[model samples]
Target: MNCLQSVGHSRFSALPWPKRVDAHHRRTAVFNGFVGTGSLRVAAMKTSSNSRSSLYEDETEEQASSLDAKMTDLSDREEKSEIYSSNMTQAMGAVLTYRHELGMNYNFIRPDLIVGSCLQTPADVDKLRSVGVKTIFCLQQNPDLEYFRVDINAIQQYSKELNGIHHYRAEIRDFDAFDLRMRLPAVVSKLSKIVDINGGVTYIHCTAGLGRAPAVALTYMYWVLGYQLDDAHKLLQSKRPCFPKLDAIRSATADILVGQWKARVTFKWDGDDCSSVDISGLDIGWGQSIPLKFDEEQGAWLLERELPEGRYEYKYIVDGEWVYNSNELVTSPNMDGHVNNYIEVFNEDVNIEARQRRKKFMDGDAELTTDERKMIRQFLDSYKDDADLDEEEAEVRASATSDAIASGTIGVPDKA
Candidate 1:
């Protein structure tokens, strides 16, 4: 009998067993080409001795199970690596964006704690008290301009009555005009000392809480918050708007913070040739040191520190007497026809406020009628032609018109 017929199957039994065995061998050879030599060898061995065939089948089943487990392990490792990589990327991104690299978080300074002439209202004082503000630092020089005409004595009396709140005044006129070179470091030192002693919130303010306050605040943001100068300016504007009207102040502030400007001390006689008299007695507001520099050649005293953007009151010590610089330009008025020197530092908040105001007008939400619009345009055009209105005056006029419209004193035209 042929091998195939001997192995069983009716069709193969009818044929010569040898021919059927030959055909089965050919089929095995063809199948082996597709299934691989190892599988073919096992199948061939299965047909041989029964004991050897069983052993080969068991080996083949073991190899298949081993390969499946290996593939599962590789897939699991790949998934784990992908997850780890994604988490690492996110962590790196956060590290790059975080403001405080040394782990100090930015503490929010309560608005009420900040001392200012603008904050003289009863509601504002009450708010300050409620917030547990321990100290008020007034940076204003003139009591008349400052809403509350309370002197140092009055402030001390009030503090005594209030129990916890202490009041200190630094007659800093044009505080914003202090040269940032000398001013920034001195102010920062003073503020740090105050914070250490009070251990509570301290409010530092000048007239509008914009110029001097923002300058000092900006310095704090840089030293404490580790912010770059540009970023520091932006952060200050977010808290309080300070727009520098003076070009020098703007450039000086930028230079100081970015290390673009360096200050050197020099001493000489003025035009009067007064001996190097100690003007140290005069307080230009930022404690102790009289920031006077003598120019030997010009025979004039030049301020070593460039003032920050804002108005300032400064007097040169002539023959041991304090005297204002008549040549210095001023934007705000003072008592003696002497204008207070003003500087405008660039502030993003000013632009933001302007944009918001423009949007309100453009949206027609101000309820401006056609007649009112025509009148407003006429007024603006007239001022432009006359060259009569300064920026502040123009802004005041525009704001008044807008306020009137918003209050319904002006009406919009009906649409057909």
Candidate 2:
């Protein structure tokens, strides 16, 4: 199977994080690919602490000077910070100016992060390494690499040979919005490990560096770096000329609040007489369906899958007829304006009070009470603690207490 289809399978999408690769196998693969290049020893795998020892090593005076200038400029900049994006529109003029400045496909969007097009040649790897990039993150699928004649095996070999730079790949399809949204969390998680845990200057790229690469970079800044979504977009736009699917990024960030929790969800249908039944949605992807097996014991058709905590809209196809749940309370209009059954799956860790407020908002109760608004705000703020572990333990504990208050496990004086 091609990389795109392979990644779409449960092996990748079913997890909250990327599947771990064995270090030995990876080392062996690198060794085998670079056997004739010269006397080259395979270094630590991406997950190895030994590899990160050299992340900031061999710094040239030019690189140091460049980094210092960047930091100084960043400190001097006065960008307004907010918890939410008041406006989501792109700055078209800034985008054009940045694109004009980006003569090459690659440019440093941040001090530690470089967003660029696919690395087409081994020289490209050398170019990036010369700038102190310790990690190369490729977001293109196998087919995309082949189309560009990008020798990925050679790129990996070159990255390994150059100060043991880490080469990581996420097989995301070109222009696939759904795949981008679904896989973005895992992408950002790996990027976080490289930049935060490993202390590496990471270069992220896709086929053209226009779509997936920028999207991942923007999401990282927004989700992990605590920039508001619009601020993150503006930051990236000011550096690189590209359009990331912002809506998908926003959706992914929304999912992150509860993405850590996955519960085995079962969809049941009382279609005993129907010849077949199918259940779909919540990572099954709308318009696609997986069959529900007959359950004689329960006297119903059942489909069970581990789903991350979120509200999912789905419909049942019984004997080739699409139908929503008869109970209108659980039914909502789908994108096509058709009524569909919706389910809110959550674990005990979920802040039920905040969830209830969100559900009320979703159910057309836009006039939320003062307490409800506060609960929702606290819920979002509490999850921001996961953005950075280096934050104070006391602050994290307080966020946890906020979560408890939102969950109604802790009582607070009625401020309203």
Candidate 3:
């Protein structure tokens, strides 16, 4: 069963069919059993005794011609519906393809995923890798050149094109079956991890990258791209010139992904009286701290990043001192045994930003960027700090700190 043996199951007939004519017996097999959901290569294995086996054993010349014509008509209509139909292929411009080899018509469905046909030549693989593709989603088994051409060796042949481009295969037989809906969560989750961690390009393809790949791509769009179901469908259609048939994507997958999107939260960070913000748990940069720009609207240094359901730890640096959240009774430790403040993100659809917007606290804040505000705050803080020192020393220290703050040499400090 794993090796693409024709099982003659009812599901096989539901797959994108290819016409196979038995020249000797004048019989035809339109649909066949699929290889497991490993890759897009539907290594079809046709059953020997078709239940609809016709008695064309003694077919005359006219009957054979008629059968051939019927097959041709069916194939032509199938082509018209394909994403790679000649008109659609030409309409997609250079961004898509339906060329001689494996007739792939790949186009970007999202910032993360590109859907298309199989890689026909080494150049095709090179083109993908050149643009920072880290993963390839193959839809077929070995040598479906009529649709696409690929094998482990064939894909591995161009390994140097990337930092070892990884290959993922998910054999698609029944796009709308309960099996597909059940598998959708795990598949979408893995794809989400790849896009989230790397933020790099991924090439997803079935032999044609049309029927099966688009279905999976649509799922990715809904779950990971943060798009609504209708939006995802429209975007996929605009790029590839077709969306998966209504039957290809089940309602359950749509509900799960759409629900996930609404459950996610936007984590916003605002730094006051600081030139930059650094986090110990995330990649701020290439081992460098990220500088935050003062946002006049927010009246603080702001950075907004999306966060999913998880526990994260972070600390803020203001005026060269770390501010730990007092909410945590006991901080968690990293492998190095150091402690940091933590927060748990849940599916509470609360808008922290909107509430904060109504209350603007410019009272004694020292992070103001305007020159007039800076001087006024500096004078007030100076008088407060100057009370403790001798007259001459207080005058000198006040001038030094004020000048340093004005010159951007040091971050301004607030009251003790």
> Which runs of model 3 end up more than 4 angstroms from their true locations?
1-103, 141-149, 174-179, 254-416
Tens-digit lDDT string for candidate 3 (124-243): 776787767767766554434343223456555564333435555545442223334444554555555444433468898865565557777886665444555567787888887644
Evaluate model 3: give its TM-score. Answer: 0.36
lDDT of 1 at 95: 12
Candidate 2 residues 285-368, lDDT tens each? 443578989999888888888876556666677887767768533543423345667676667766877556444433433333
Better of 1 and 2 by TM-score: 2
How much lDDT does candidate 3 score? 0.47
TM-score of each predicted structure versus truth:
0.33, 0.44, 0.36
| TM value for model 1 | 0.33
List model 1 lDDT by residue over 1-46, tens digit each.
Answer: 0000011112221221243332113222232133533323335333
lDDT of 1: 0.41
Model 2, TM vs. native: 0.44
Model 3: lowest-lDDT 10 consecutive positions: 1-10
Error of 3 at 241 (Å): 1.4
